[model samples]
Target: MLKPFLSSSFVSGTRLIQRPLYYTKRTMSTHSHLDDDCIFCKIIRGEIPSFKLVETDKCYSFVDIEPLSEGHSLIIPKYHAEFMHQLPDDYLTDILPIAKQIAKAAKFEQYNVLQNNGRLANQAVPHVHFHVIDKPNTSTGLGLTWKPLKTDMDSIKTRYEEIKRNL
Candidate 1:
């Protein structure tokens, strides 16, 4: 039998509730692809504490400790993958939808959905994770500087063709 515990949740508002089916540590650790040394894997297995927001069969989300802005959070696949391309499609399917739901539940009017790949790209963790950063004001959240490159249409078209052909 599953155990029940009193917890607060935000569906529309805070309400006392029982733990979700996936809340059990054993169930959360059942993903066969987890990386033993990974911090996220430790969190999922209850080895580390986290303010977890959501957990599905394929994904888990929680508040960011080093938030860029208020309401900053992270969503990650249950499976361990160093890069997005290495993750299975089934795991990818849950990420965006969960992110959207989290944004809505948080009542964030403006936010940025961001992800990084390699160390050069500023990916601090070697795991596939998405960030939902709330932009309550101009100074908060992700700031960007656009740097457009000057290129010939021929070069662009050739590259596009190559990608399309592979797809």
Candidate 2:
């Protein structure tokens, strides 16, 4: 049973209608499962076509279908892991060398590495992936729009010093 919420039609004195919460719950629950039909999974299985750059027993690197830059690629574990923190250390270690190789191969002056964890972070696919984007010249493929916030320098310095002491 789901609670009925007033829709635009209902607010205008239309018929009382309700939508089931079960549908939303089912959709949410499905997100937790890595889709077997996912393009990345198919790439891992060699069922779908991809321009593979590097591959190991645990990791594979391939050019991104929708690239942020000229030579943007995705590094993913062969075994599906939804988030970065969920990845094993061995799997994590395996991808970095490949990422470095791809960056060098692209002749990039600089590169940006990015990983998004959850929906709020803009992770469209549930599968864990790291993006290595190449920056050829003075331009970095990554752009950030930030408004500088005024903070007390002494407070910032004190916080840094405290963290450094712990280190």
Candidate 3:
């Protein structure tokens, strides 16, 4: 369910823009994540178009417009959540199953699951989404180049202890 809205705003890279959003003429939604300005909300409402692959009461699956691989896809909640921590517990649990099914349907042997949070975390869109990339489907899957640094056992223990303390 979503509230009536004329349009939605979204961040494309560092720039923000407003675009049309379509609402299905439902009663006011109580979902906290249903932001009127979020692009994902517009997508859920069928405003901005998407090559949707699956639709559920609480979730939606679609192909990535900017695919890292041929079978790359995205799974999201119907509601908008800026980050995983902002989403409801059930949404977090529901999205993964949808992603798994998408992978199975594509007959992917290997893939990568990715989620980004804030800007520094490379979250281009201000909505919670999971990227499912079929590694075997294309050579560009993820294309992530990581710099691995060597660390000693004591450093590992210190890092672990730091995270534990913060938690």
Against the true structure, whose lDDT is highest? 1
lDDT of 2 by residue, 19-47 (tens): 22111122223223345877777787677
Per-candidate clash tally: 0, 0, 0
Candidate 1 structure lDDT = 0.81
- Minimum summed lDDT over a 10-residue window in model 3 is located at 19-28
Evaluation by lDDT, superior candidate among 1 and 3? 1
Candidate 3's error at 98, in angstroms? 1.0
| C-alpha TM-scores of all predictions | 0.83, 0.64, 0.72
The best-first sequence of candidates by lDDT reads 1, 3, 2
* True-vs-predicted CA distance for residue 69, candidate 1, Å: 0.9
- Model 3: per-residue Cα lDDT at residue 63: 94
* CA lDDT scores, all candidates in order: 0.81, 0.69, 0.75
Model 3 misses residue 12 by how many Å?
Answer: 40
Q: What is the clash tally of candidate 2?
A: 0
**TM-score for model 1?**
0.83
Any runs in candidate 3 off by more than 4 Å, and if so which?
A: 1-32
